[model samples]
Target: MVTYRAYIKKDYKAEIRWEPDHPFLAGLARISFMTVLLVIPWLLLGMKAPELTPTSSPVSKSVITSQQDRIIEPSAIDNGLVIDTAYLPENEIFETTGLEPPELEEIIDPINDQVTEAAWQSVVVSKGDNLARIFSRLNLSARDLDAIMALGEDTLVLKHLQPEQVIQFQIDDNQFKSLKYPASLVTTLHVVKTDDGFRAETLTEELEIRIKHVNVIIDDSLFLSGVEAGLSDNLIMQLVAIYGWDIDFALDIRSGDHFSMIYEERYKNGNKVSEGPVLAAEFVNQNIPYRAVRYTYEDGQSDYYSETGRSMRKAFLRTPVNFTRISSGFSLKRKHPILNKVRAHRGVDYAALSGTPVKATGDGIVTYLGRNGGLGKAVILKHGGQYSTVYAHLSNYKQGLRSGNRVKQGQIIGYVGMTGLASGPHLHYEFRVNGVHRNPLKVELPQATGIPEEEMKHFTTQIEPLLAELDNITAKSGLITVNSHSDLRSSVL
Candidate 1:
């Protein structure tokens, strides 16, 4: 150590001392102090640390062991909660500390099972409302409308649609899926999705062909007379076909001719849809009554027959005319306008516009087709055996028409004209048997063959009920008239 001395004032001199090596000792002291400062806190904190306590009660192990041994009583209790030691013991302390029982899943019901039916929107078509316009107003797509219209051509005719017809649509999720209509009758359409595509099925009530009769007096043409008598158009067509062979509807119908018919009227949903076929019909011409009945044979052939089972169809039709007016009838010792002499008029003449088609009277072979004497252009058809028919006054023959050509009955052979020694445009029709001229209108013609015998029994069974219904309608109509021409006008012809 180094020391320093100093005198402070002459009277009292004082000595001062200084230590030069104290810095080195000070460094060692600082290090020693820092060491103690760091170790003392750690040592105190470690001695004061908290300890973990036991979670289970002391009796838990005993209770668990007793349960496992099956020696614990049910009355054991701890913390005011009774312990089911017999089932769960304390030694097996239920450690629900971090565990939870499985959640009970909630049940849900199916949508379809609980769904309520959707409401249907209905619209009644007022006068002048059409399906297209209405559907457009409802914002339906053109493709959807087209699909509905494509159902059927016959089913699409809106002329039959009437005012106030109820139309209903089932809209699910704003899309049209079903439609229904009910007027005097009801019709339903169901739309279903299939593997191919969407399709519509039409469901309608069964139609019952019913018989209802009402009598009408003949006052005019048969067509008008039938309508006045409440006969449906379908029935009228049937009547015409029935007597087509015997009656030349274009000419032979007289004002006084009366008719009575029995036929079926079809009804669906208690409303009349149409009238079916005529079962039987009676026509009185010139005081002679003609009757025809519909008969079907086992061979599936249907024909009109007389009461005596004679076929109503003749072997040859009365005339070869097609939509023409009869100008004159057969007359003997009559003066020909062109010849200006008392010559025999052996055939009837039909007046029609030039170029009007003429048909063959029956199936036959063309024997001749050329000009001859006064019979300008002519065609001669030779039927089987002794029957032959001649057509004169033709403007031109049908294409490929020549001698030796086979022609079926009703086939067009030529056109009408004043070709031969005639006055105006007309057809000269003649019928001959073994070359002997006979009145075409008055000849007793042979009937067509009836249905085969084998089919007769089945035919009778099938057609009998239909015929009965038709007869019942005819009788009820009371429109039947016989042999009275005065009230009927000549306009009917």
Candidate 2:
């Protein structure tokens, strides 16, 4: 049995040695045997392996002969045709053709529809016209106007329509859609049309009031001095506003009448648009001093005051002469231009053209308007609490002006003329406090109310920052010069 086993082992080893020496031939034989084995089951089950086509089947062309240099040509069967190529593998034939596959189309509903909306237009109000008239001119229905008017009386007044005030209208095919009124320094309203009819809306804008301090030092002309001191002409006019009741700027400002003011300036977006009231001011005329301080009360009313808490505003101002030159001044001994005599000059003389209107210096009842000895065409006003002002030498009186008629501060009473106590066409102004003659330019007038106690905290908070800004500006401009003296040290400390 051992010898027979050894002979069988030797025969098997000899059979292995007799196999083909070419690896290609050996691999071919093995492939043929595996193909036969794979085909038998397929054939027995009544199934046939698909023929490979270059444009179709990719699996059949993937299997290759053992020789790398040999290429397989595809079969000509229409079901699965394949082609041989020197450039690329048969599986990549479809990709090399550079043809994109057909894409599936997206489905959309054909019955859907869409509608577009329209836009609105805007308009601004012009001068001397109200909103109701504007709406009427636009051909809006009376019902709509009535509806708008019914919103509120305040709303109607808000719509009183100042120049450049903007208003918007919304319409759809000539039918009213809505209306929009933007808030400004005035009230604003908005209305919209809905299924239930028109609905109104109110939008309020919170006003941001910012204060700035502006100072002006008169050096040359008032206009030039204001420009040099960074004071806007508007602010300068405002500084002279309060004094309009007292002094006529066109006639009263002297050459050396320097003025200092702390006034309220308003700004929007860091740009100054308008100015507020003058807060505090000091005006010096011919070496005489006058000061005014503005104060706000608990009830939100404001007035000018003196340092001593009296009204800076008196029952009367010092003079009524307006837009005139001081051709002559008060003097104890002087040659009058017309009289040529040394006479007691009791009043200051202002020279102006004839028919130049003279104003009453304060609120008072007109006591006299006829004439006096040597004084032609005079008007006298008796002010409150034993004070009176007289305007003499007039061409005529203002219309409807007569004795016993009440006059407010700065009311026009008469005109300039060469009347009694003769000179050229000039105005002689006199001030009598408690029936005693006092120097109109030098007398200490009664004071106005001071800053109210309730508004003190608000004023301080608002004014501190403005004062700091003013200090910075003054320092930068070198307007305030500091002297190394004991007084300076005391002031600084």
Candidate 3:
């Protein structure tokens, strides 16, 4: 209630009483008041300071370290005031003392435990390596090998380890947790340890069969031309077999001859594993074109046929045996090499190495299978009705073959030898129609069985596209003069 000017000049004090007889008491009272006055302002200042400052939540040792390491000094902006970082409180100073964080063991200990828990080892099969030897080398027990082999025939594929084949084993505590063997490009054998002994499973990888086409012109040899066209030797051999009956590859092939084919390539994991079968093929020999398309019947029997559905096989193969060259051809009157006189050389002589396999040209019964006068070791085959073939100058006959024994075409009947009138290792082959001799190379052989009438529609439908594809490639590339797709199909139909 005092006036404002009077209140500004007012002196506030607390009253105290002291005895006049004791001067020391008065001195003590004066000193006590001064001490209280000095300590009051400092105590108020300490309490007010906590309220003004921004309070932070308690942080762990790891969190403090992460925050300090992440912080960067503030940079001046266009010569303006730069904000500097404040010092940490005394309690948090120990957090930045260069000690390892407690959470690192919390994170890395689990990682180390995982690394030791699951581990794998791989071993490649070396030369002369068997399952027993391989397991022994790896310090695995014999019982483990026996258990793996006892899984049955499917597991037996793992028993035969070819050199360079790899076997991978998942190990835990020096024992096999699982085993994996890649048996082939598309197959893997897995043996896993289970509570109930060991279990084996075969994992068959899916394969992609891609159809590919190639066109090749004969300049030198078929083999060389095939290689140039990126075709494998197996594919080339298959191509030859498809057209072998219609074209005598050794004698009938001429300059400007060409071939085109569509075949299958098996792929696994985006890489080509091997070649499959020839799907369709065409060959032009001496201006005549031969076309073949492979077809599989409902019963799984497969064979090559013309677009018109005629079988590519014939009653006899053109050549009885694969030979180097034609040493002698069929002739009515010719001088014998050993006889030194003009005599009828009724057969062709195929020059080859001694012991080269001689195959039966046609399915027939053995009429004679013994040594002959001038032909040396000979075998005479009598076919149905009008056909008869004679093979001579043989190294030896196939065992268990005798007169009256039935033999199939392409069966090995004997071997090449320099027997009888031959001057070198060669095969003497003769073909007769009824009692009359004929040129084996020029004879018109009977066609094999064709597609049944009921299946012709499907076969024609399937082959048209292949034939069209082949002709398209040939025409575009100017590879050869081949029959038009329609013309070839009509001939077969």
Winner by lDDT: 3
> For residues 12-93, what per-residue lDDT tens digits would candidate 3 score against the true structure?
0100111223364345446546766785454334323322233232233234433333232123224443221224653444
Tell me how far the alpha carbon of residue 71 in candidate 1 is from the true structure, in angstroms, after superposition: 87
Against the reference, the lDDT scores of all candidates come to 0.60, 0.56, 0.70
lDDT of 2: 0.56
Indicate the residue-level lDDT of 322 in model 1.
45
- Per-model root-mean-square deviation over C-alphas: 47.5, 40.6, 37.9
Q: Between 1 and 3, whose lDDT is larger?
A: 3
Candidate 1 to truth, TM? 0.54
Better of 1 and 3 by TM-score: 3
- Tens-digit lDDT track for model 1 on 1-493? 1111221111000101111134643554465468667854543232112101111333332334333322122233233343333333333444421112222231121221121133445666788888787778767666777766776643364335576555655555665555545433445454432335445555566678875544444565565687667665456656777776566554566776766666678864333556766767666655455667777654666678754455666677776764345666677877777777778889878777888888887889999999977889999999999899999989999989989999987789999988978788889899999999888868866666665577566556765664465456546655443532221222142
Query: Using alpha carbons, what is the TM-score of model 3?
Result: 0.70
Report the error of model 3 at residue 476, Å: 4.7
The reply for model 2, stretches above 4 Å from the true place, is 1-118, 126-143, 150-155, 182-184, 194-202, 213-222, 228-230, 240-273, 278-293, 304-316, 332-343, 363-365, 384-387, 398-408, 417-424, 433-493
Give the TM-score of each candidate.
0.54, 0.56, 0.70
Clashes of 2: 14
